[model samples]
Target: MATLLHIDSSVFPAAGSASRAVAETFRKAWEEQHPEGTVIYRDLATDPVPHLTADAHTAGFADPSAHTPEQAAVFAERLKLIEELEAADAVLIGAPMYNFTIPSTLKAWLDNVILVGRTAGDSPSVKGTPVTVVASRGGSYAPGTPREGYEYVQNYLSAVLGDMLGLEADFIVPELTMAPQVPAMAELVPLFESSRERAHQDATVKAKTLAERLAA
Candidate 1:
């Protein structure tokens, strides 16, 4: 059975989070396509993984036999996350914008899983894996927008997940997520709705298409 690694890092739950909501939509579509497939889910907000420590970082480069007890313990925890990514057929991430970048929790997860010669570098273990990221943001950051240059979530992930890790990365962005709640941006609510609708549609289509491709 195909395995999917789904990671959500939004501070809020699905009901209150644009990224989580869209991610859930994709997951539902994926589940429908593969009724018997396995899904390994991690909700970073609720159960955040440990931030990468010096021991964990140093251990990845050192031989396992040389690891001290402290290094061995932390490296073991990091290995579990790396193994999950390696075992997955596909990946889904809800990376909501926080301070114009990905959430710290999501960053921590990435740090744990990324090993220089293993999950990253010239020939990554999970190379060619497809990863769909829901990069929801509070405001518009498209080309010509004032904050366009400030959009770092997709750009950063592209470099890390694609260039460094060799994952095939695709993004579904739901922007202006704060429109409905912010009085000054109330007028953008309509645009937010449209963007959100488009994101959900993209999620469903991508999930089904990916499921079919994996099955093939």
Candidate 2:
């Protein structure tokens, strides 16, 4: 059966999180297409993985047999995360922008799973796997917008997830998410609604399409 590695790093619940809400939509569509498929779900906000440590970092380059007890223990945890990524056929991430970048939880997860020789180098184990990231943000950062240069979420992920890991990365962005709540941005609420709706539609279509492609 197919497998999806679904990760959500939103601190808020689905009702309050644009990324979580859209990610759930995509997951539902994916599950509908593959009734027997497996979804390895990780709620990073609730169960955040450990941040990378020196022991874990050095162990990746050292031989397993030579690892100290501390390195061994930390590296074992890292391997579990890397193996999970290797086992997945597809990946979905809810990367809501937090202070102009992905949540620290999501970054920690990446730090754990990314190993030099196995998951990040030329022959990455999960190379070419499709990853869909729901990159939600509070303000508009589309090209030509005043804050376009501040759009580090997508740009950073593209480099890390695509250039480094070699995954086929795609993004479904829902911007201006704060317009409805921020009085200063109240005029952009309509744009937020439109973006949110389009994000849902994109998630649904992409989920179904990818599912069908995998089945074929």
Candidate 3:
């Protein structure tokens, strides 16, 4: 069976966030289809990992075998994160847009995964396999419209992951642009539920196809 990793990185727990709901829905359906498939989850909100430190950078510059204790520890941690990503047949990344971009916690996680020669080699245009990104915004940010001009999450995300890790990024954008004005229980709640439900179904099929590729 293929391995699937689900990661959520929303710092806000008080306000209901669309990205968290969507990620959970996708994870549930994926697990149901692939009952025996290994699943791993990392919630950056509950327990955050440290950002890339000076030690991490120094370690990244050192040779694997000729590293100091601190360097080895940081290197080992980075390796562990990448190994989890490499072993996976599919990946689900959750993020609630913060100031028109991805969360810092999620960015740190990406930093952990985008190791040279591990996720991607020295190539300039390597194609990363598909990764589902569940992104939520308080405003609409889909491309080709005026709203999209202010948005940098999807483009920046696709560029970094696709360019460095070769991941073809897919997106599930359940926008809550009109939420603040709507009635919570009657309007926003139901919208989030149905939107996430729809995204979950789509991601289920995607997960199956990804698994098939891994099994091949």
- Per-residue CA lDDT of candidate 3, range 73-159, in tens? 887888778777877667888878899898888988887767665566675222455678987777556667568788888888878
Question: Deviation in angstroms for 167 in model 3?
Answer: 1.5
lDDT, residue 116, candidate 1:
92
lDDT of each: 0.96, 0.96, 0.74
TM-score (C-alpha, index-matched) for candidate 2: 0.99
In model 1, which runs have C-alpha deviations exceeding 4 angstroms? none
How many pairs collide in each candidate, listed in order? 0, 0, 2
RMSD of 2: 0.5
RMSD (Å) of each candidate, 1 decimal: 0.5, 0.5, 3.5
Clashing pairs in 2: none
Candidate 3 stretches with Cα past 4 Å from truth are 13-15, 123-128, 177-201, 208-216
Candidate 3 TM-score to native: 0.83
lDDT of 2 at 64: 93
